[model samples]
Target: MPTPIKMPALSPTMEEGTLARWLIKEGDTVSSGDIMAEIETDKATMEFEAVDEGTVLKIEVPDGTEGVKVGTVIALLGAEGEDAGTVDAAPAAAAAPESSESAQPAASEPPEPTPASAPTVAPAKAASSAGTRTIASPLARRIAEKKGVDLASVKGSGPNGRIVKADVEGAQSGSAVPRREAAGPATGQAAAAPAGPATLPDFGIPHEDEKLSNVRKVIARRLTESKQTVPHYYLTIDVRLDPLLKLRAELNAALEAQGVKLSVNDLLIKALAKALIQVPRCNVSFGGDVLRSFSRADISVAVAAPSGLITPIIVDAGSKSISTIATEMKELAGKAREGKLQPHEYQGGTASLSNLGMYGIKQFEAVINPPQGMIMAVGAGDKRPHVVDDALAIATVMSATGSFDHRAIDGADGAELMQAFKALVEAPLGLVA
Candidate 1:
């Protein structure tokens, strides 16, 4: 009897996902912990590892198949000394073809999605890592086609020399044959818009539609729900940044040989966590009948990724030194961009910090990510007139806004947290102490 390979839940909240790619095919021998496929969960594109090792008997879901529910048997594995081709087709409903050859996905690939699975984002090279197919990431293929680059000639850079989006962007044209463009949808993707039928009438504008990745769709749905259901209020404060900047320079000089660098956001994350400790009332989540207060701050830092904005948490940020926070933040951010972030790397935070200072965004209020009581939005620090020791002088200042769930945190408590955050940033040394 062959064992069925069901789609595992990649996250605590994932119910279904797009089977982004199948790294292994039928007749391939796999072992425990082998990465068999990439699944696009609601949060990120994560690798699905094989737990039961055996020869790949079948692949029920072709690459790029969407909306596959969790626990769906995606493939089957044959025990040692078992023949893969003769495995029962009845298990996965012709998971293979009717012919003698089994688990051939190209035959099932259709024009509907315009090679919907065309991108092997982490592309397999001319001879794939699996030694069976040429793979390019879906995005890479789309861009390659649009840019007149041929996949056959471009070398891949991903694992096993897989071609990724970045690789495709810089590759020289591999063909002058003028490959025909695969037409389906436009390439426009929005983090805030749900990808589906156009909800409004078009004014005869020439545009092609692009399918929304799972991450974009989830962002659109969740943010909409948050705004509609959660009662929100905003509190803004002006904080001087000169002390923080000065301290950061001193710390970086001291820690340079250690290769550790601190950003304003890292210090701010620590300040927010400490402030949450000082005003515990603000560190809470709202339940309809109960308010859940937290003892520690797992601050979710908002990072802008290729897909959308994701908040990877700094767990127990209050207890970690600023250097540690900077190190962890760098690691988490890299994972977030690569779409390899695990569920625990991003889920369940008591609060969030969204910094746009680098982009020179003067000030903006961020919408609160639900269940989390509040989000601190930090803007750019510019020289501004300020009162110091009862006299007005120019100071490096930035505006910070806290968006709180009125249901979970009182306005006064939110104010106190803001005050504490401001004091910590202004004094600066308290952060290291």
Candidate 2:
């Protein structure tokens, strides 16, 4: 009897996810804690670790499969001294079948609903006059289509001469006859963005539909919900940034020995965290009739990654030193961009900060991340005429807008938080102290 490997719930909220890629294949030896695959959850792409040490006897779910439910057996592993090849798939039958609706495959393989069952078929004979369909992996067929390699012309080298990914990759790229579509578990390509009445009229213009990744999809859903359900009110403030900029440069020079550098956003994250501490009324989440106020300020700093917009939390930013915040934020941003952030690293926050100053956007209100009371939107810092010592003087200034959830925070409380933030940023010494 072989041990069944199930699809893991990568996050607390993940119900289903895409098995983006498989690192271990059939007949591969794996130890406990070894990364076996990458699962794209609702929040981020995370590596799935192996739980039991054994030889992978069968991979029920192939790579590139989408909408695989949690607890579905994805593979089977053989114990020590067991023949990996001769073992029956009886162990797999004990597991329930997958019922992922979004899975793409030919209509002929409809009886078995899951990806694990879709690819277990006989070898495909090259197409001639008989109309016998080809047997190829979903990924192989996608590659063939992209390279225009006729499946009928290529020889399959997989089990019983089944067409697999290697066969397609080794085949020469050229013009060929129509491809005989193979019935398989999942396509190699990302699911293309659904075309529908949901989209606008093309008006006969040429266009290509791109797929929305899991991250992008979640972002869209959450942001849309935030806007529609959350009663939001905006408050804007102009803060003098020259002192902060000067302090940053001085700090960087002094800390050059420690190799710590600070960005304007880093300072702002600290300011917002401290502001939340100063005005606890604004650092809260509205849960129906309940208002939950946080004792410590965890600031969610928005960072744009290749996947989409993600807010990595700087936990207790108000408590950590400036150098500590800079270091942690840099690390988090790097991990965020690479899609490697852990769940806790990106999940919860008391307040949020989004900086468009680096991009030179002057001012804009950001949507509040759900359950959080507010998000500070910071814009570009540029030299402007400002009052100094009761006289007009030139100073570097930046505009920041706070988008507050009116259900949780009153306008006055939100304004107080903003005022505190501005004073802290302008003063520049309270943050370090």
lDDT of 2 by residue, 109-131 (tens): 23323233223332223463467
Worst 10 residues of 2 by lDDT: 116-125
lDDT (CA) for every model shown? 0.79, 0.80
Off by over 4 Å in 2: 85-92, 100-200
Tell how far residue 128 is off in model 2, in angstroms. Answer: 23
True-vs-predicted CA distance for residue 145, candidate 1, Å: 24
Per-residue error for 34 in candidate 1, Å, reads 1.4
